[model samples]
Target: MSTPRDLMIVALDVAPSRPLGRGDLSLALAGAEAYDLLRTGTVRLRGDRLAPLTGPGPDRLAPLPPPGPEDGLLAEAAAALVREEPYEPLPDWLWRRGRGLSSAYLAALEAEGQVTWERSRWLPFRGGRTVLSDTEARRRAAYRWAADEPVLLALAAAVGIREELTPADPAVTDDTALTVLAAVHDAVMELEAVRQRRALEAAAFANVWRGA
Candidate 1:
């Protein structure tokens, strides 16, 4: 029952039974979309050396070049992602990744029954809101990965959510599975440090203008 969005949702709701505030939803969605794009070859990440995986023929290490100008959120974020210094952490560089992607994966996650939204008691329309959700599936996956459960272990390894990263419990293990968890954590931290960071918000509003 777990979907790609759950990867981000688990990071947002570590506890199995609490509601998550909507303020961070934009950042969470960005992380989810980043993971999907990365997993599907829409983007690529190089270890340590950190050069973007995009270039000419043999030079084109990325599965696909970043999306174009009219392609929307993933494109915008990919454009920003390659600009960071090679020495910077991938998570840190992704603060601006996928600029207007906060809502794309959410509907899918909700449709899958992993989360539920309840209208705000006060400002039902634009005010702050939170959604109820759980992390059972992700937690279980993490636990299996830690225990070196064969199938999950291979999957995690193939994806770089290395076994050495997990502990004995069904825990986050530095939030590695989908890569989005760590990125979301960093993005939120970055957003907090610099409150003026409104690119995501601006892009979000712009979508409304385009009738998206």
Candidate 2:
């Protein structure tokens, strides 16, 4: 099934070398993956922890037969967390998940020849970098992106991308895409607020404790 994660992958047609913008693509992918699994009935979510639904397979947790690769990737990620932590909120799981996942996903796409990256050695840093081979070309073609759907637009806005969206946008109108986008946006914003509050509270506590 072509899910939001798939859209995210396409939207991020940036070469591995370029900045993937300000938002966290990994978190975006994880949320999309969890929502897709929830919709597909291959998995069930309990308080942020994703658990496989009982089925014919000997291992309920095995990556659901890839309706698409993103499914497998997301399943693998979720499964790993379930194994490590008994229960972790999806957002928390996303923050604590390992690095390089976004790169891995892009590499898989590169292997499929759907996209390509070029390795480059720039000055001031001996370590070379990889960049999307034709970022401008793909960007020009992406003009039609998310025209029919606004979930991705919502994601962009949530991450401070500031897309030009109308009141008719799914995020504003409360459409199906909103189900995914709003959930992601709300979760991310709520988490950020919680984190800020905690930081402030800690600072206050430290000031008092240190003074005493």
Candidate 3:
């Protein structure tokens, strides 16, 4: 299973009570995709920018390498890569690709029978709870998460699952992975800043409305 998918499963399984912010999860997912692509040699970092190994196309958008990622969502991410020179910066790519990415992964997991919905009988109109299925994918993700696998831990930390980002894990010695993790951390912080600004704006507006 792909790292993003595994990360999603691990997030759902471990923190059902905490429930990740979708925006944070999406950023982490994008980072997970970046890390996996780098690991697989389907993409490389040209000094913190992504350079997907894709073929040329008419509109400058390109196709992914043959048999890109086994997961369709990940393959789609590869296709979304900026094919031209001045390739996208890692943080930019995360924000762009991460928009609604959590929903996409959730839908994909539902379709693959990796997740199921349990609705209250009396409140059928309301949204139901999503439960992970007892699948091999879940087991594999659980094992990796249990092992404190560096990539997964880093991704989880970005989403506030882990308390803090620590020194680099010896297991994640690759420069590419380290770069991707750093970008993820910065992107998540940027997102949190945006959220804070929006919240403050809303509160100010509310006070103005009350005064008026």
Candidate 4:
């Protein structure tokens, strides 16, 4: 049988924005469930913290101001977040444009009911042509984190299940293994709920903007 890692390797090779096909969705959901088990398992894997997945330190995970000229690096960073290789260093104007595009994409996702938006304010700081406050960066991170929940859950579940099942035959089962699988399933479901909500919100928002 193919292991979770093998499945995930295939998934990651695909583009992030690729719409989830039925098979893809099934695998992703299963993977998310398996991940929860791994985290709570006895093996105690290292580097499971939310900080590394999200960004810098926990404290830095706050809302940040809009990007400025100096913050052009953010565009590259954002592209990286989506796992897209940066093409060229974005110019100040292009960086701003990219930021706007990223925000719009998030907002669209929210309107479509794939995610939710929580409002917060931040103090502004200078960058290039625009000013970015620390608060805005934090806010962006929060949104990004939320958006990434589904993928993360999938990854975790896949790893967890793989670790548990690799040593035994496909038919083997113990109470501990069963419990871990259940937890993984539960986590994936929660993430799916969030994604659905964001998608709905994004659709609604787009409708309003389009005046339809």
Whole-model Cα lDDT of every candidate shown, in order? 0.46, 0.51, 0.80, 0.34
Taking the tens digit of each residue's C-alpha lDDT, what string does model 4 give over 38-72?
A: 23231212222445767532111111233312212
Residue 109 in model 4: lDDT? 37
Kindly report which residue stretches of model 4 are placed more than 4 angstroms away from their true locations once superposed.
Answer: 1-172
lDDT minimum window of 10 residues, candidate 1: 55-64
> Top TM-score: which candidate number?
3
Clashes of 2: 3
- Report lDDT (Cα) of residue 111, candidate 4: 47
lDDT, candidate 3, 166-189, per-residue tens: 665535677778778888888888
- Top candidate on lDDT is 3
Cα lDDT tens digits for candidate 2, 173-208 = 543334445556655666568878999999999999
Q: What is the lDDT of residue 21 in candidate 4?
A: 35
Ranking by TM-score: 3, 2, 1, 4
Clash counts for the predictions, in order: 2, 3, 0, 48
Global CA lDDT of candidate 4, please? 0.34
Where does candidate 3 stray beyond 4 Å?
16-19, 48-67, 165-171
